[model samples]
Target: MPRLSLIASCLLGLLLAAAPASAREVSVPPWGSGESRGEDLSIWLVTFSPGDDVPSWWGHGSLVVEDRRLQQSRLYNYGMFSFSDAMLARFAMGRLEFWVGHSSVGSTFRFYREEDRDVRIQELNLTPEQRVTVAKRLADNVLPENREYLYHHYNDNCVTRLRDMIDVATGGQLREFDRAPGRMTLREHTRRYTAVNAPMSVLLDFMMNDEIDHPITKWEEAFLPDELESQVAALQVKGADGQLQSLAAKSWNFYESPTRKRPPAEPPPWGPWIFALGLALGGAAVGLAAWERQRGSRVARMLLGLENAVLGLVLGLPGTALFIMWWVTDHTVTYRNENLFLANPLTLLALPFGVALMWGSQKARARLFKVWVALVGLGVLGIVLKLLPPFDQDNWRLIALILPVSVGMAGAFGLDRVLARLRGGDRASTGRSAAATSLKAP
Candidate 1:
């Protein structure tokens, strides 16, 4: 997937900054309210549901500190970033910087409400000291020098940052969740959320490597906002009287958007469907090749060339990107992708052969046939690797999509005849030339 263009980023920045003047004040709730137990302070977890945009597809969360005495609420958001060229360049280089910034609760809620995202709030049941600590930490986090931090999608994102702070405030009680197994892998979680956009889901799955496929702990799963909310709601904390109570003093759906629905619990079942689509395309290519071979018609040959070109571009472009992601960039999740075998870069290199085949070049036919065979072989190799203990990438969907197409195209172009002729050496070359001449005869 391409990075957000500068224009889109700027527009998003503007939208984020366009809050009403009354809601624009940066309010930090007063932590010291004269009460020895800090009775006037309250902390809440605010979670916003996923939105239509790519960036908002994973959802977001913020820490809200409220001062009951002053009736003021401040939201500490860790998802802020600039849209300047320098920041975008760094983002493209996989070194994005995000910072914590304070905004009025009114402004934050207004923006998300306008976007039609669901909002949930949970009042944290923290002791007075814990509440004071969390409030002060959030205040310190928004400071100019302290706010900026390196962002890691799975480990140190906005949600995870809030999760860590909560865990610390609870005296590491959240660490108890490390023993529980996660429902799915990071890749699956990502697919589940992004499944609302089918193409984007597949593209992201293709780009990510096996690093995200391992089973994680529930603690790790808290990287997502909803997951964290669920885990936090289940937590039990000891009260002043030594009785265990729910960590969430109160929980409620603050705003449930009628237009936007929550993402599905599981990722879409797209593998089999994509495989079937590939088979259909491959069959069509074979039929076209057969028609061209039988009639030697100009139209059939043109269609054959066009099919090859289209397939080449579709496979080659992403394959080239995968190559760059593995060796040229710092996107760790995209490194060592298994899809590279299915979408071979050699297909791009064989563009001239595709064009030549359009003009009835025998040499191009031979070369293109060889390239297709190599691609098919690589696809098979990927499957074979799956049988080994070391290769555990879940890329069957891609294999299913690319393998049959390679096989069909190779068969369509007469791979057997090409190989037989090549084995026959000098005699076969002369025979091919005579055959070409004879076919051209009126």
Candidate 2:
């Protein structure tokens, strides 16, 4: 999930900029600008639970630094970005830019609380020298000249920023965390959160390629806010007594929202399965019409031809988009997709011939018969390829949904053409036999 706070903060930034210059500058003390210094500063890791919005589905993370003497708290957020028309275009193309921002902790906490999102905080155990060093690093990072960073969704984000900064403060001891056994792939982790957002889950599954299916290290999974929080809470570091100590000295939930009603029934494999069934039924009807050659069979054939052409055109879109992302766009995860063979855009180019067949062109139907046979072959090949190495894509759901439809549609058209041709030959032979008998009798 990208930063949900980014959109809100960007709008707020624009509104504040229109005010007077003195007022435009947020009253929050600039990072490290307070009169008080030394160990009076304490470091905290703040986490906000997942929200209803798409961007907030995975939650958020922020680092808070409090000055005891000044009685003020500041939040260092790595989730801010400048939103604009140009930025939207770049964002769509996967070239993202984000900035570290400084803001008052009171306002930040209030915002999440009002949104009814659960919030938690972990008081980090850091030496006085370590605290000052981390604070200074954050201060420099939030400076106008040093803030902007190229954001990668899974590798570099708000949560990762906090994790990295803490590791720095801990003298790399954070990296010594024991790997959690039986780690999951990035896709699995994402699916766990987005299961309720069925549509988004399907779209993400389609757009992202096999790159996400590879198992991620526990450290890599810490990019997610909740994962980072849990990992930080469990982290152990060297203590002054020569024993391991928990990195978090204390932890507590800052806010808890009212319970939410359970969501409606989810449409998981159901949606894809229904789509396959519909296609299969339609193909079956076409096969029956071709075999019977009834008075209305021509119309039925035309309609089936037209429908498949349209369906083919539509199905090709995701594959085409993936192709662009892999070859043309900068989206790293979409590169090297194995789903291309199963959802080839080349099928869409057959639309012109499908239209011709719909208009009752015998020549077009003859050519399309061959195409349908090829489709059956391709479907079978796709199934066989799944059993091979390097093609080991975990796309069983997609394969289940699409392969049967392909085979059904192809068999319907191919077998119909063959049966019709055989019947025509039989009728011609019978007519010739009847004419020869009549001539001989005369």
Candidate 3:
């Protein structure tokens, strides 16, 4: 599971690079900055929930917005945020001020400021028509097409929302496959946070000046008195039923500076860290529950579960290590490298060895179990250490590692627990093994 997740993470980076794309930058001053103080101020926010028309093939994003005013852009899948970068040159040769925040699927969250600017925002008089237009355009015009700018997404959230436009334009004929109308099948993703434009960069951005049920005073802190006095504020869009749309973008007072600090969410340093570790605990809890069902072998099942988990951790490490090495890089369009590694020979052989160590009778090779456990610990350590610089940067790009690490860690642990309980030693009979994982053709 973890190996497959690594491949998926690496491949997602590839797909973001290889997809078909377009670019459109809206000219707006940074949220609080106005005319003289700021010229390139812009804010682009997009949300892609499950029910929207985005194609599953495109792997839709959610809650993503890029604002040059705030100098921040965070992409999302479903409602959770994923990190993404915008080329500064992509925006008419102006300097960028940015920030990022996102949580992983299953309640994990990460977000923070990358660079804090002393810049202040000004309030421009926007006509009611202009305000409606901006809101509707956000709902309609921006954040649709998604990805494929050849390098990074310049408001891909809005481009992705364009999927809705295409669907409406074609009367649902363009992308019938993903049009399930009302299914809660949204899958959130986690990815990178980038700054500056490389090669395929483009311009136009968004800035945020939020005012929830927040203190009017804190707003004064992040903005100049003149700017705050000008009166630009966030809008609240609620459906008739008051339910938030999957594709809705809202500017809320999530946090403010000085008086109310925004705490950071950091990366886990070791293997089986955080999420997977939680999963292991979850599996252990389940094993504890099943303890009563097993004949005298319950103790053996617990031990085997430990062994299977260790071996799975070891077997999946190489692919995972390889994945962590390049998970957030913009080097591939097809991400086929990690995908291919999952099916490698060594991984295949190791799966059964792991299973045997877990399910083999009480007399199973304790030596093999100990050896595999040591190897896995080393493999995890080596990868975590190698992951130092970029992988562990303050950037949310590290979130990509969570899926693989957690899944692989959990799958191995869970399967081992089950195999121990069942004494399901016959890998051939079950006809399942690590060799079964691999890349898929598009």
Candidate 4:
């Protein structure tokens, strides 16, 4: 999360500029000209699958074209972005600008291969004219005026760029013919890639709102590189014989990561459950102790204080962060988040109240008990919404981790209040009896 290094950014630009020297211009022949460019025109859908680096975590996509007539092989990449101060600031604000960039196919492949990333190459089925059209479009996209675009991760990223370019070249054949639905939603697809980085996956789920919940069609899910390649492989277009033909003639991996492993279909489902159960158990124990009036147990006091500090800080920090993201940042995906209710920064008020309740009088404890109950109610509402109709947010993991702590804190605080009230009632009754007996004797 540190500021982007200026020197590293400069070096990155230099590396990209120096990587490809054998690139050539693509010609745009007039449309409907039956002239065959007899050149060995090779068009490929290049997919650079995820690697260990944060930048490559979502993977990247590019179009590779080799025109033997010009002895040129170039990769048209739609994932390039400057790391300048202004660009980094915009990226952090979620208004990133990415650009189409061209480099030698050799250079592109070498970069991914050296990173130990998984790289797949699918030879595209294109007519000589279609091939020239794709090349020309790609070249035009890489031009200074046309290259830069507003980058939206799910809708207008590297993968979607390639999908769109192919769609345009084949008369929208890729999107039109690729209609099979996937078993997972866009959120699930994202989880598959980020699972290896648990913290990143959790942070992503926390920041992104319900915008990614609903199921997406295969064409829509092609925002991911793997999904895009798979969808395109089965895509069909009208052939010369008036029959449907596969868009990809053949597919093979250019570089397979030596350390690559199959990621889980989604983030581990059991993680939230385990975390919630721990909170529930702690709450039950504290409630039982309060019911028995175990004020003398130093261990209970210590545990209660520890719970308050941990839970209060845990809930408060992320809630504050999420709230800021919703209002302050340009990340549309982070806006209108429901997670705010569960972990409101206002819950941080509990930390101070918790200390006072442990050491202060019954009046102080009673006053703060309502706050605890309110926090618990918020968490319950979040959990309940997860089961209700039209609620599609995938936050079970979070609800599981947070709700139990809320429940435990509420129970402990409530039981303490009940015991305090009962003790006060008993003391008042004894005073009344003594006064009545003394008055009668006099």
Number of the top lDDT candidate:
1
Considering lDDT, where higher is better, how would the candidates rank from best to worst? 1, 4, 2, 3
* Better structure of 2 and 3 per lDDT: 2
Residues 75-191 of candidate 2 have per-residue lDDT tens digits of 888887665666655665667688788777777778888878877899998877777787878877877788888777787887788899998888787766735542677767766
TM-score: which is higher, 2 or 4? 2
Q: Whole-model lDDT for model 3 versus the true structure?
A: 0.30
Q: Rate the local accuracy (lDDT) of all candidates.
A: 0.76, 0.67, 0.30, 0.68
Q: Identify the superior model by lDDT, candidate 1 or candidate 2.
A: 1
Q: How accurate locally is residue 356 in candidate 1, as Cα lDDT from 0 to 100? A: 83
TM-scores of the candidates are: 0.85, 0.80, 0.28, 0.79
Per-residue lDDT tens digits for candidate 4, residues 1-442, read 3422332232121112111222344443222132325246778998776666555667677888776665666787777776557775565566777777777677678887887877899988877767878777776677678888887878887778889888887888777766656667877776777777665566566666888888678788887777778777878877656688898989998889877765565656657555856577556646644844755665565556555766666567567666765776676777878777667777777666656545634554555567667877877777677677666677777776666766677777777767778989999999999999999994
Question: Where in model 3 is the C-alpha error above 4 Å?
Answer: 1-350, 358-373, 376-442
Instruction: List the candidate 1 regions with Cα displacement exceeding 4 Å.
Output: 1-29, 32-37, 84-88, 350-363, 415-442
Off by over 4 Å in 2: 1-38, 83-85, 178-182, 260-310, 350-383, 386-388
lDDT for 139 in candidate 2 is 75
Error of 3 at 51 (Å): 5.0
Q: Candidate 1 residues 1-442, lDDT tens each? A: 2433332242232112111222233534465333323577899998998877667777888889888877776888888876567765565456778778788787778888888888899999998888888888887788778988887788888888889999898888887755599999998888888787776666667767898999999989998889999988998977777888898999988789987878789988988898998898788777887676557678887777878888887677667766765786676877888888887578775566778878877788778788888888888888888888768987777778788888888787773365455657968788999999999999
Question: Residues 2-92, candidate 3, lDDT per residue (tens digit)?
Answer: 4434433433321231111222343432221222222322222221111111111222222322344455433222212222333322221
